[model samples]
Target: KVQESARVSGILHDIGKLVLLEFPDFFKKAKLNKQGRITQDSEYAVLGTSHSEIGGYLLGMWGLPNEIVEAITFHHRPSIQISTKPDLLTVLHTANGLANMCLMEMESDFGTYLDMKYLDAIGVSGYLDEWLSITHQVLDNTDNDQVQT
Candidate 1:
């Protein structure tokens, strides 16, 4: 059940970007003025709320599970979560950050980073190295699995 929740949350986490696309002017301003800053901060500055929050709200309105809603809502800043116990939210947050770290360009200023404090609070900080190793291995396998034209 937990894994399913995480999977669903991951799939839906970026749904708000579609909604935000309706306001191209806001995105243009955010990109121009909010370089080198966290994406959620720029989004909030331009749209009055972050995509995570918007996605969460939409999920909630659609009657999705609260776990999925909260996971998507606070994946960018899990330290702000009310519960310190590791759960679906924690998994989603950590996985999202790690994926971003691996896939994003080095020179990009997207500001994707792990919340170590949150992981420490949940007693999961010790697993980061192992998780990163597994991430890299999975990425390697994925690259090898691709069919070249």
Candidate 2:
């Protein structure tokens, strides 16, 4: 299923965080001081590299497909990816944004770094309201299921 595939992509998109966690000292030092910019730029400012790049590099080294590596590498900045149509990168980015929105106050910036131009460029901006609605319903269901359990 496309949804299940996208969910897996979403899970792996942030595998960069695991790379960051591998280097606790470096991760501690890398903080995004900038207000409006995305995390990658801030990470570059602090550690001279970004978690996404590191994750991509590691995954590539392990012989993962280039497309998968590319998606993970550009998860935070999917707008920069060079492609004519929407692909896994677009899905991962939108899913990342939707999940963040569902997190509400639990996530910083509340998915603020989401680029409308990117979604517009990818031709998915028109469905954002629908995405949000579906995401919220899914989150609500998850919460209710957890409470019941």
Candidate 3:
């Protein structure tokens, strides 16, 4: 069940971006920072909200599991969570950080940063190297044609 939750949460974590796309000026108003990075503060400054909140609210309204909603809501800031136990939220957050590192070659301004404190609290901080290696192995196995340039 935890694995399933992680999968679903991962797939829907960015669903709010789809809704944001409806706003014609979203990309324009939500300007990237001087480093060409899109931070949560920048998103809030322009749109008055962040995709995490938007996605979490949507999932909550749909009556999905609270854990899933919480995971999506706090994936970018898992350290704020009160729970010290590692859960789907923790897995999603770690996976996101690893994915960002692996896709560093791509011009994506995802702005995902791993919460080292949270990882340490959850007793997984030491697994980062192993996780990164696995992520690279998976990426290597992916078909080049299916991978976007």
Which candidate has the highest TM-score of all?
Answer: 3
For each of the candidates, the C-alpha root-mean-square deviation to the true structure, in angstroms, is: 4.6, 4.8, 3.6
**Model 1 segments more than 4 A misplaced:** 32-38, 105-112, 143-149
Q: How far is candidate 3 from the true structure (C-alpha RMSD, Å)?
A: 3.6
Model 2 per-residue lDDT tens digits across residues 1-149: 55765655666676666767666676556554333223666678767878788888887898877777887788778777876688888877777777665664334333474667787876878888787778778777786434210
**Residue-level lDDT for 33 in candidate 1:** 25
lDDT, candidate 3, equals: 0.79
Off by over 4 Å in 2: 1-7, 32-38, 105-111, 143-149
lDDT of 1 by residue, 58-100 (tens): 9999999988999999988888887768899888887777666
Q: Note the residue pairs that clash in candidate 1.
A: none
TM-score, predicted candidate 3 vs. hidden true structure: 0.85
Report the lDDT of model 3 for residue 50: 84
Each prediction's TM-score versus the true structure? 0.84, 0.77, 0.85
Residue 55, candidate 2: C-alpha displacement in angstroms: 1.2
lDDT string for model 3 (28-91, tens) is 7777755476677777898898888899999999999999999999888888888768888988
The 10 consecutive residues of candidate 3 with the worst lDDT sum are 104-113
